[model samples]
Target: MTNSHEKLRMMMIIALFAALIGIFSQLIIPLPLVPITGQTLAIGLAATILGARYGTYSVILYLFIGATGVPVYAQMTGGLGKLFGPTGGFLFSFVISAFIIGFILEKTRFNISMAFVANIVGMIINLTIGTIWLKLFASLTWEAAFLGGFAPFIIGGIIKAFLAAWIGILIRSRLESAKMLPKKATIS
Candidate 1:
């Protein structure tokens, strides 16, 4: 494809992934302070398949959509209020985690093993930032933040990490073969 066509295709894919993240966000297991959602899994998949530039773009787009009052967040909630709420840290962390996850794959190799490691690291980043934000935003103690924000998500994060690795690699390989995505990520 020509440069313009390629750029358009990439943009469309980014938008699609952003929508996917929103859809996944609705898969919520509610908790007192937070919810376990498929948002992370979708984030991992986006990073694994799209790499740093596009994956992060997708996440930003998702956040922008939600912040604009789109019901795209967990439990079908959205708006700027959600973005600044106690769980806002988790939403913000998605950008960083997606970038790092894709960056790791770009730096190493876009394979299941590497993707798994990257996803785990991304999960940790999400938990850390979310916990800290919970403490500060909610004015809770550090222990409360850790218990409510970090501890509750550990097992789910691991499962999602593994699933993202396995499924993301499979889908990415297929897309690469079909020329839907480049074998290696590029900013363009």
Candidate 2:
């Protein structure tokens, strides 16, 4: 493909992933402090496929849409208020987490094990930032913040991480074999 075509394709893919994140955000399981959502899974998938730069761009695009009151967040919530709410840290962490996961996968040989480890590390970053935000914003004790924002989601996070890693690696492998993946984003 020509350079222009490749750039266009990359842009389109990033936009698609952004839309996916928005759609996944709606799949919410409500809780008192923070809702469990499929946003993380989409994040992982985007990172695994798009690499660090584009993956981060995809998430930023999603956040921008939500901040503009697109109702792309969990429970169909959006607006700047949502971005600044107690759950906002988690939302913000998505960017960093995606970058981390993508950078790791892009730098290393793609494999299920490494993907799993990358996802777990990303999840840890999310949880840590979210927990701190919850405690600060909600004026809760550390224990309370952990219980409300971190504890309940542990098992679900692990499951989602594993699924994301497994599915992402599969898709990536297929794309690579088909020569559809961008050379810049793949291991040469």
Q: Write the per-residue lDDT of candidate 2 for residues 1-188, one digit (tens) a residue.
A: 89898889888888999999999998989898898999999999888877788889999999999999999999898999999988899999999999999888878867888889889988999999999998999899999999999999889989988988999999889988986667887434
Model 2 quality (TM-score): 0.96
Give the lowest summed-lDDT range of ten residues in model 1.
179-188
* The best candidate in terms of lDDT: 1
Model 1 pairs whose backbones collide: none
lDDT, model 2, position 171: 89
Best by TM-score: 1
Candidate 2 colliding pairs: none
* Residue 9 lDDT, candidate 2, scale 0-100: 84
TM-score of each: 0.97, 0.96
